[model samples]
Target chain A: MRATLMYGAGDVRVETVPDPVLRAPTDAIVRTMRACVCGSDLHPYRSMHPSATGRPVGHELVAVVEEVGPEVRTVRVGDLVVVPFAYADNTCAFCREGLQTSCPHGGFYGNHEVGGLQAELARIPFADGSLAVVPDVDPASASDALLHSLLALSDVYLTGYHAAHVGAVGPRTTVAVVGDGAVGLSAVLASRRMGAERIILMGRHTDRTDLGRRWGATDVVAERGGEGVERVLELTGGEGAHVVLEAVGHMPAYEQSFGIVRPGGVISRVGVPQYESAPVGFGSLFGKNARLAGGPAPVRAYQDGAIADVLAGAIDPGLVFDTVLSLDDAAEAYRLMDSRASLKVSLRP
Target chain B: MRATLMYGAGDVRVETVPDPVLRAPTDAIVRTMRACVCGSDLHPYRSMHPSATGRPVGHELVAVVEEVGPEVRTVRVGDLVVVPFAYADNTCAFCREGLQTSCPHGGFYGNHEVGGLQAELARIPFADGSLAVVPDVDPASASDALLHSLLALSDVYLTGYHAAHVGAVGPRTTVAVVGDGAVGLSAVLASRRMGAERIILMGRHTDRTDLGRRWGATDVVAERGGEGVERVLELTGGEGAHVVLEAVGHMPAYEQSFGIVRPGGVISRVGVPQYESAPVGFGSLFGKNARLAGGPAPVRAYQDGAIADVLAGAIDPGLVFDTVLSLDDAAEAYRLMDSRASLKVSLRP
Candidate 1:
């Protein structure tokens, strides 16, 4: 099987690799129909994160079950499914609490124990809990756009929804989305679905801002950092945003998200912050009485509803995929994404 | 009129000053029947906070309305009242949202525009919103303890209650209180009132721990910093506390409060963090899905109910006041509090 592997920073390649096989009783093997690049992937791609020698590159996927282990009961051969980015047992107390991202037995695919999905086939552990069967869509009939939404359900879409949901966005709320990447744009869509009265996208690029507008951003602040927060406050009657979605996993974006939220408002951050310890402005948080909530999206927890929204045409999350290519072109896809020329890239296996 | 004036740090004197007269249309002159030294006051008294030249030092008080401006409608002359430490206009949007402390028209009584209650008489602005009538208590029959409770309601007691309430404590929730001061002790009481099943008080002193136990702390962690968070997590089955009340205003205490709370848990911080840009580990908060809330307590918003609880003997918040002294001993009271020899000090006017 062909798999996308990274040898070092900016060194992505598609090479022949052994096909995945069941190694645990709860594991299942799946033939990947679609896979995609995630913003988090860019962290290591840019060498901002420690580079792993010969690392397999993607996590988001929509596939058909090719084989199942003895303990796998819900999924079987020929079943089409959406696999969440994180693997969970589904029976742990944390999983029961809809916090699958922090499940005691959970682990992320493409990192640690599980292998990446940018390949011909992949191994999925805790299959019963990690795989969600797609009800009616035939594998061959699924369009790149629809397949892209299915792939998004693995991480980005659900992550954006988690950011919006945890932030308590509602009809009376005004949301400021920091980061114009796929997840941030998805947050705009999620906030809209959650009935936010206004959605502001903070992005620097015209193309990303245009995509954000299509995804339900009612306003856009093209400024970055402190100036962006100031603009958001100005747009929101100087009260700041009622809810802020921080999708960029960097210090400046995190600080901007915190600064622009109003008193008693919430900053829901989905960005995977890379720092060990960043100085938090406690005085600002204390004085404003604001709240901060986020984490790895509990994608499995919202799989049903989010997929339904995608199927119902209430949202076209597929718009986040600006570039679509064959799995063999994964290296170029990584390059395009790193160059900031594409919002997201989808790969067909 | 006599006032407790601080000429500089470590120099407090009870000296004659001009009598407070109505300075605003909504102001009222109150003759303080009783006042108390607060943990916050010690900040300036110990030179932790810069002292302003010729500042009057007390904000917690139970007083008799000596005079009222012609525009004062809610409070009348000769009425006994509890004056909230903060003065706010009841009609501001922030006040309407129950965030009286952040009201656009609000100001801290002692730190800002007016002389505080350590004086024989003090001027209170926004009288309609800042003064709560003592509906059922007879001033003559009230014990020193009861008067302390009224004074506590002006700030500390209500501040503690707000912390627990904002943290969303209730049955089935495990609460961890970080701080051993009067406000933290009051939070133990407040958490109990809110029906928290397991209350853990984090402190070091045996005396304070005993008081916490009496006030409904089911468990106590005497360790400080990271060790304290570890103890809380160990006690909570390794999941961390569901709600944390951060009552101490310091970096270590704030970090411990953050570390001890579970993913999706709430940290209500009523502690006035003094530093301008205290380091906040947003990644930890983001990864855990935790929430941080609270500022100055909206005392004026909760004073009536707090007073009711005190009068009904449902709570003895005055137990926090371990020292009582004459108005002439104001300097000594400040010194005792600064030296940590007293948890709180009540001054008789």
Candidate 2:
């Protein structure tokens, strides 16, 4: 089976890889239908993070279960499913607490033991807990838009939902989404679905902000840093927003989150943090009583609800996919996403 | 009037100072009935923090209103009150949000123009907001225990309550109070009051742990660093506590907070942070979905309820006051608290 592999910085290729097989009674083999390059993938791609040599790429996928072990009771063969990036047992105390990302037995995609999502065949452990069935759907018959939306449920949409959920975005709450990438745009969609009355999308790109407006952003701020905060404050009547969703994982994005949140508000970040430390001192988040929450996101826990919303047409998070390609064009997908030439890119396996 | 002044490191003196006078329609003059040296006081006393010359030393006070300006409607002359360490206008958006410490017009003790509480008289700005009345009692007639408990409401108790509140401690929640100082012991009491079923107090001091047990600590862990985290994990059946109250202000304490909190748990810190930055990266707090909340306690917001509880004997946070002295012995009070000879010291002016 062919899969996307990263060899070094600026080196991405589609290479034939050995097919995955069921290793445990709880495992299931998924034949990928759709996969996408994630914003976090850029972190390692840009060499901001160390790359694993010849490792498969991608962690988001909507796939079909081709085979399952005897103990995999819930998931069935040929079922279209959303595969959350992290595989959890869903029976641990942490999983019971809806923190599947921190599940003691969980492992992430691209790890030594698991096949990546951008592969023709991926072996998933804890199948019942990690895969959410796209009920009654035939991958071959489903609309392209629906498939893309379900793929988002595997990672980005659920991540954005986690951001909104942890930030406590709700009716009457004002929200600010930092970053205009797919994750940020998805956050705007989630904030809207969560009943936020006012949403501000912070980014400089005209195309992204336009999509942000369509996705329920009440305002858009193009400025960066202090000016961006000022504009957000101005838009929110000088009080800042109640819930600030940080979708960009960097020090400046985190700093902006601190600056534009109202006192007693919350900043939920699902962005993969690039910085090792953040200055959250007396003058920053603490004195203001602003809470910092959300992390890698409990995608396994949120996938079901998000997929249900996507299937019901309550949200259209798939619009974030501005570019699409075949599996062979993996390098171009990386270049587009890395250069911000596309908000998101989808690959058909 | 007389006040306790910090001349330099290890130099505290009781000296004559000018009496406080009303400078605005919002001002009220408070005659200090009781004041105490705080655990945080040792920060400046030990030269861990910079000390301005002749700056008054204390922040916790149970005082009586000596005079009030025309706009001070809620407090009256001769009324006993709890003076929140920070003065807030109460009408600001932040104050309305119960984040008085972040109020636009708020100012901290010894920061600038506001006089400190360790004085005969303190000129309180935003009197209506900063002073919570100690109802139906006169300082002259109140019992010593009641006075000390009420004094705790002025800072430590309210601070502990803030930690519990922000950490979201509630019925059946397992709580961990790190740093068994007065604040940590007070947090134990607060967690119990907030309906936590199990409370763990982490500290080595027998005296403080004894007080912690009296304050409803169900378990006490004496180990430090890795061993300490292991002990806490063992006590919680390896699940960690649902809420960890961080009362020590330093990097180690913060690191310990990150160590023992359950995934999706919260670390509420009322300790004045001394570090400029913390490693809140993806691998530490963010990935686990643990939240870091609480800063300077919004005492102005919590003072009334805490004082009422103290007055009603619902809690006895005052037991932390293990030593007492007159204002003339301010240096000794600092010495006792500085050397851990006293959990807290009350000084009568």
The best candidate in terms of DockQ: 2
Candidate 1 C-alpha lDDT tens digits along A1-349: 9998877778888989878888999999999998988999988887834365588878889999999999999888888899998889988988999998788888787743578888899999899999988888888788877888888898888899999998889999999999989999889989988898899999889898898887789998998777887888889888899899989878788778878988888888888886645534455566777877777888999998878888898788888888899999998899899999888999987
Write one digit per residue (lDDT tens) for candidate 2, span A1-349.
9998888788888988778888999999999899999999998888833366677778998889999999999999999999888989998878987889888899899855886788788999999988889897878899889988888888888888899999888999999999998889989988998899999999999999999999899988899999998998888788888999999999999999999998888889889999979978877887677788889888888777777788788888899888999989999999998888988999997
State each model's CA lDDT, in order: 0.85, 0.88
Report the Cα interface RMSD of each model, rounded to 1 decimal.
2.9, 1.1
User: Model 2: runs farther than 4 Å from truth?
Assistant: A48-53, B48-53
CAPRI docking class of candidate 2: high
Q: What are the models' TM-scores?
A: 0.96, 0.97
Residue B99, candidate 1: alpha-carbon lDDT: 81
Docking class of 1: medium
Candidate 1: give the TM-score of chain A. 0.96
Give the per-residue lDDT of model 1 (tens digit) for B45-140: 767344556777788889988888889998988788999988889888888988888787888766436886888888998999889998856677
> Model 2: number of clashes?
0
